[model samples]
Target: MSFSIGIVGLPNVGKSTLFKALTKIKVDIAAYPFTTIHPNVGVVRVPDERLDKIAQIFKPEKITPTIIEFIDLAGLVKGAHKGEGLGNQFLAQIRNCDAILEIIRSFENPDVENVTGKIDPKNDIETIKVELELKDLEIEERNLSSPTKLLQSKSEGKEEKENLLSKKPIIYLLNTDGKTQYQVPKIKHLIMNLKDELEILELSDLEKKELGVKSKLDQLILACYNILDLITFFTVVGQKETRAWTLKNGQTAPEAGGVVHSDFQEKFIRAEVISWQKLVETGNWKKARELGQLKTVGKDYIVRDGDIIEFKI
Candidate 1:
């Protein structure tokens, strides 16, 4: 039920700055390598406008949104697979994450040192990719020699069944200067200036609009959802609370119930479901039922985005 994304890149690619911007958490940001020796962790709420609309209709006493954790890991360098620049520790930190957000620097600043000595996005990407692939190969080789090592690792909850770092979902973020022209890579990528974003973080919404500053952090979070193939559902507890939950795209009703509580999944019966939009349009549960918009679904029901579900156990 918990999901996380690891932020990684070469030295001084704004990994720590991006983390500070996204989570509003203060971290050590410097112009040098290994500024973040230990991984910096922060939980970010998954942005959902649907949750806001539902709360408006229900007038609940409390509203809870689903969240994802972001970890700012130490930068990786060439020969990282062989423990270059604290690479082994950094690589180990990322394996526990469900996805990766790689920061690719396209900005040129003489003050900020580029460990690779150039501002080529293509080469930078390749360097990171090769290192990750080599590390995965190293892990695979070790696993082959001692098969029980993997089993013991799983039992201790220190390793995943699929241990390849390259196999994980990755999103490349091109940290740009907004002035230079760079060739966009043919992969899942986004462009933004981390410094500019951080500057506007303290500004009011009106101030941001007046300055023509639009934040892409929301879009970045949504992209994480897409890469993970996740969907959102809702639960309204009378007039008390309305909360949002996340599930895999094709997950069934019982699995969704389990996210809320284990007993709901184990003693499952049926679910009273209605799309959030329909419920909002009709104004209440009674009106939605009167319009025949409410649906009763069994355990086999695949939960959809924006569905307001009442689980029967």
Candidate 2:
């Protein structure tokens, strides 16, 4: 799936630095405010060690990792809702994203001038939240303002109404504690209510470490994947390398095969599947097959995480 996360924050908040760190690619970072008028897009690799084990097991010729795209949109000013600072266009760039990674200015560096003239992480976070809430509210208002209600059939109208009422989920990212102190403010005055309403996750340091296996970059991407409810499966051909494949949770075998190649899906016969645990115990595919530990499944068999699947075509 072409899933993506939109990275948004005020100017000079280190969104570009985070993007560069995540994607390991260089992008234009301006020294002053409003430097990034156009957002930079990057695809970040999702780290998985299961790929190594599967490679050791089946030894596929190639390994494929999953990725999520991130776009660093221009900074939002105080009056973003009022069409200030690339306002509406920036919001529109984020509309198609699966979710948002809100970057709040949580760091205070004397070198990095605060356009607002002060450093307050809470205020920074609240500013972004209020902007997004207003953006969503505007969307909701537009949906309500539509006069062509009769154009849709009864069922479609009901579905549309349901959609207009439901809130889009967001994941809040407080970019590494940057010297700024955390201070709690009044719930109503802050963005706490909006965050709760949207079920937004305020990432904590403990959670980040626990989620990643090695690197913080790896952990952040893993967190994003789990947050999006994505699943990973394995494909091991009898080559030297093994690969990891990602599919939506509950995807069927043929559909999963389609992720590898449409031809694989078309020519599929049956899938010989073994769980990672079974492979670890059985030691090899031949042993697993001999012991009938390998499951011979049809298209309906749901692809699972860590499944070493050898598609029969």
- lDDT by residue for model 2 (18-123), tens: 7766775677765577878888888987888867766666656677777788887788877787688888888778776666776666556677767887666678
TM-scores for all predictions: 0.95, 0.79
After superposition on all CA atoms, what RMSD does each candidate show versus the true structure?
Answer: 1.9, 7.4
Looking at model 2, the pairs that clash are 59-239, 60-241, 107-178
The models' CA-based lDDT, in order, is: 0.90, 0.70
21-89 per-residue lDDT for model 1 (tens digits): 999999999988789999999988999988999899889999999988899999999999999999898
- Assess candidate 2 and give its TM-score to the true structure: 0.79
| Best candidate (score: lDDT) | 1
